[model samples]
Target: MSRARLSPALVVGAAISVVFVASALLSLVWTPYDVAAFDIGHRLEGPTAAHWLGRDHFGRDVASMILLGAGNALAVSLVAVLLGAGLGVPLGLLAAARRGLIDELVMRASDVAFAFPALILAILLTAVLGPGAINAVVAIGIFNVPVFARLTRGAALSLWTRDYVLAARMTGKGAARISLEHILPGLASVLIVQATLQFSLGVIAEAGLSYVGLGAQPPAASWGKMLADAQTLVSVAPLQAIFPGLAIVVTVLGLNLLGDGLRDRFDPRLDEER
Candidate 1:
């Protein structure tokens, strides 16, 4: 098979993702200042020799919080996507394989999920479970399930009609076996692209939740929470909001670009169109 050409979007997205990932990981070892430590003496201090990005209204290091926030955002989004794709992929496969009522039921359920927005679900979940990172993950993950299920089911439906699938059926291969071995593999590229897109959505969802006090509670740095905290201070300490805002924008853009690139690479029709 011929190697796929790397697109500019893919390269740039990868580079941006690498920077965020590296900063997040590096935060595990060191930050300019302790994330939780605060100093009333230095509240709202601008960039200087001591604090690179300056300080928040609470006198906490903005740079440190940002670095740690990257980890938080990445963790929550990663778990949300995993929960979504893991359960969604299999359910979709089952629906496609069984057809008839099974397919209808699954599709209907996805519609129900789609009816409830992620923020609404997060609010409800937080009300029931109390706000935290885990609840954010669960709420976001639940919301994501329907998205993956629909995508997977749609992609698998196409694969089920392919020649190899017919040959497998002729060889006495059961629906489950064929789906696991053949159908799933055929849908990998589509699923991957979908996963990347969903991951960016997950990050945004988590941020939105955190912004409203439903995610990664107190002392746990989050980009959304950072924005929330900085909103009032924007007139004075704009850097506080700016840094986190940029983090969210850059991360989402990178993931989107990566997803678009992957779709182009995997779908021959897209390449031809380009």
Candidate 2:
């Protein structure tokens, strides 16, 4: 691995990721005001002394809602990413370490899974489970499984041929034990890089789920839900859509850049090339 050091892209990406992550965390303890409390009297009012970002049609403070919604989006995305990584990484390692039938089956299954997009999967899940945040997570996570599995398998395969791994195999160690002891450690940098990229995609998937009434429900205050609510009212009050849209854009872009930075910093292949 290359030495850990800051680049311009890394600094900017980390800054954006931190700001949004802090905003999400802050909502757990506090917001500008009560997000659920309605003040119809102030509905659609422009930004004022009391309402910094103005109030929506429901009279809920836009800033407060955005803050709360940040929490929703982040939570959903983070969980989905973790779910994918947790399940997919192990499968990849097992396939790589144990090859033969296991490798064939895992790779074939991943190809099958790759066929369904997150939105399509979400719709299928919503049909059976009903639309909710959990369904959105499941949908996004299932889609991500193939992504992580393929990447992990490819990365892990290289590690399997390493001198340390070949030596481990000579000791008559079981595949699982060898994978855990020898190969898993070597795959961390690749997994971390992939996780960051998937996390950004998860954010978008969560938002899209919420937008279509498949994720967070009413009063849950997800960024996508806010956009859905404000779409029709854009002519009446454009800022309603603008703020949440910007939130999604900035978050996704930052995560992508962060993933890029990690790739540049962590990829030994890239280092060798450079």
Candidate 3:
């Protein structure tokens, strides 16, 4: 299907996405100082001297923690997104293609998953799996699967009824071949939109889990964990919470705007408006 070029919203979203991606990548190579490095002399110091964002209660550099924390947040989001998309997309495709017992089973399972919110799932998983980064990933990923599965299935269902799909069937294209060759291409725009939406959700979920202490542990520096650590200090050291909270808000906002722009740019219905 034909589509219009990117709009202003998309351009801004792209810039924001690039910034966060670069920040995460840079954190892998270097931060101004080691995120965990502490000096008692610098404890609770405001932004000045050697520390740009100042030091935490333990004298660890806040700016450094932010960099490393951004990296961790990105990492968790990526993994959770990948896991959800990988598992959910195939199920959606299969449900659309198979459309019988298999579809019934898959859809039912996805519905069951829908009963629990991502945060609730995270809390449950944390209880079962115990607090850590991996557990957070799994919890978020699990919640994502149902969302992607339902979205993909709906999109694929629409495609399955298309004339091209009927034509493919007339040519004796097998279900798998028709799905890959005819259906998937049509669904790409939908998947891209869904992915960005999910990415934003993943960020929120990660932060929520971390805020509750079920996310990345202390000293490892996740944005959520940073907020958790700084909650008590907010009345006195507001910067401790503000920076990490702003990071989460900005990142999620960028993803959401990007997702909306993508839907307007690529979807055939929206393209007709242009």
Per-residue lDDT of candidate 1, residues 1-274 (tens digit): 2227788888887788788789888887888888677788999899888888999888899999999998898888899999999999999999999999999999999998888877787678877888999989998898888888999899899888899999999999999999999999999999989988888888898899899998999888999999999899888889888989999999999989888878878888775665
Give per-residue lDDT, candidate 2, residue 223.
89
Summarize candidate 3's per-residue lDDT along 1-274 as a digit string, tens digits: 3455667778888788888889999999999987666788867789987777888888888888888888888888889989998998888998999989989998899878888877888789887999899998998888888888888888899889999899999999899998889888888888889888888888898888888889988768888888888889999899988888999999998888899889888766766665
Q: Would you list the clashing residue pairs of candidate 3? A: none
Q: What is the lDDT ranking, best to worst?
A: 1, 2, 3
Superposed Cα deviation of residue 189, candidate 1 (Å) = 0.8
For model 2, the superposed segments whose C-alpha errors exceed 4 Å read 1-4
Q: Tell me the tens digit of each residue's lDDT in model 2 across 27-50.
A: 999999997798898888889998
- Order of the predicted models by TM-score, top scorer first: 1, 2, 3
Whichever of 2 and 3 has more lDDT, that candidate is 2
In angstroms, give how far residue 213 of model 1 lies from its true place. Answer: 0.4
Error of 2 at 268 (Å): 2.0
